[model samples]
Target: MVEFAICLPFVITVTMAGAELANYTTTKMRISQLALLVADNASRIGSGSMNAKTISETQINDLLTGAGLQSGRLNLFQNGRVILASLQPSATENKFVVKWQRCRGMQQVTSSYYTATNTTNLNLPVTGDIDGITVKNHLVTPPSKGAVMFVEISYTYQPLVSLQFLPSINQTINDSAALTVRDNRDYTGGTSGIYNAENATRSLCAQYTAT
Candidate 1:
């Protein structure tokens, strides 16, 4: 009986740990793919102009709706958030700033998610990290006259096992992806943008406030 008692806890622990690990891994993979989906879609929205690619407010809303739908597999709406940022280079400052942003989910957007003023472009983790060490925080030269679609997904993981007994682990997971626009883009909502949620669907712009 004592031998059984000694091994029983270990067995239970292992089983619980396995379940937790499996869920964490699944969430990671799903969030990563989610980023890819949103970024790719963002790249395609344009005015069909040879000179510049641009996205309208309606298009942005539609893309956000699709993001929410694509993320349905993860039940992201219940506990996660996706932030879509538009990165376009400014002719005046010769750098990129968060032209605009939209989101889904209930979590507050991370401060690191936005394009920083004085930052060169979205390729850099922080767009305004000019003159920083290249190895650390710094802006890569954005594609000339082009832009990037940046997607960030953050989720709070709810463990299947009780933390009171298990080893500590972070309960948050986030993944991001960025892709250059196939063509140059205009930042002014693509020459007359859409405002109502009809094209937008859901309160995407209201989901996260830029900090």
Candidate 2:
């Protein structure tokens, strides 16, 4: 009976620890896939237009909403953050900069690349980098005059087991993905003027909300 008492606690701790590890791994994978999905979808957004494709504030918000829905029970918007940037080449500067940026989720985290001043073209640019940003050890360079849709997602791990059993496992998980824009887009003024109506609200980087 004494042996059983001592061994039972150890077995339970081991089992719970394993569950926590599994949860962390799954969350990490989900974050990675989410980053890829956002990048891919953002790249395809401006296609199918006869005129120069333009991205709007409403459209970017919709993309963020879609990501929140895809997160399911992960509560990603509540406990995590997503930053999407349009990396473009500055012809005169001979360097790449973040032309525009949008963000969502309640987490108080910003992009690793540059601070976003606005969701539109007037945002502060990141100069001096030939390639816009690095993701998974590779530089995501904008294609010629076109732009690259870059996404970064960060999530705080939610453990399935008690913290007492897995204090170290509950850390932040981060992943990023980038893809060149599929068609010619108006990377000039961002969501200004005709692209975004007067009443539309942009998903500006400063705001932190789940919606």
Candidate 3:
């Protein structure tokens, strides 16, 4: 009976450590996948048209809402942040700019890359190189006259079981993904017509909300 009592604490600690490790790995993967999903979907937005496609505020809201729903039990919007940006090159093609950007989530964070309508150039190379894997490297080179849909996701890890005896393992998770526009998009007006609708809510980066 004494041996059993002594061994119980150790066994419990081991089990908790194992579970925490698993949860951490899964959260990392989910954040990565979420980045990819949002970037891909952003590139595919707007109605299919041979000439060019335009996105509205309503569509952007829907995209963000979809991300929140897909987060499932993670409660992503409530605890994390999502920033979406449309990266386009300058008329000279020598510099890249953030033509437009949108954000959602209650987390108090902003994009590390660029801000909306910023004339600042991106650090990426102007030459075309899309074979890179990491988020920063993926867009090492830019496409001519085309834009890239970039997404950044930041999530705070929530441990399933707190182990007072063990060292704290909490961490802030981050992942990013980018995809070139799949079709021609209309960027002439920037975000001028996005909120043309009477009831569309703009997901401004300055504000944070789960909704």
| Full-model lDDT, candidate 3 | 0.73
- For residues 1-211, write the lDDT of model 3, one tens digit per residue: 9999999999988898888888888989999999998998888887646577877777888888898898899999988999987666755536665666778999999776553333233232322322322355444334766788888999987777864433665478898888898887776643432433446777877778888
Best by lDDT: 2
Clashing pairs in 2: none
lDDT of 2 by residue, 24-135 (tens): 7888899999999999999878533546787777778888899999998899889899998878887656577776677888888988766554443444553434445776
Please provide TM-scores, in order, for all candidate models, with all chains considered together: 0.73, 0.87, 0.83
Error of 3 at 94 (Å): 1.8
Compose the digit string of candidate 1's lDDT tens values, residues 65-176: 7777776656675677777765555554655555556666777655354534423332333344232112125453356556667777888776666654435766778777
Clashing pairs in 1: 53-184, 53-185, 96-120, 119-127, 119-128
Off-target runs (Cα >4 Å) in candidate 2 are: 115-131, 189-194
Tell me, by TM-score, which candidate is best: 2
Those runs of model 1 whose alpha carbons end farther than 4 Å from true positions after fitting are 47-54, 92-94, 115-141, 163-166, 184-211
Lowest lDDT sum, 10 consecutive residues, model 1, at: 127-136
Error of 1 at 151 (Å): 1.2
User: lDDT for every model?
Assistant: 0.62, 0.77, 0.73
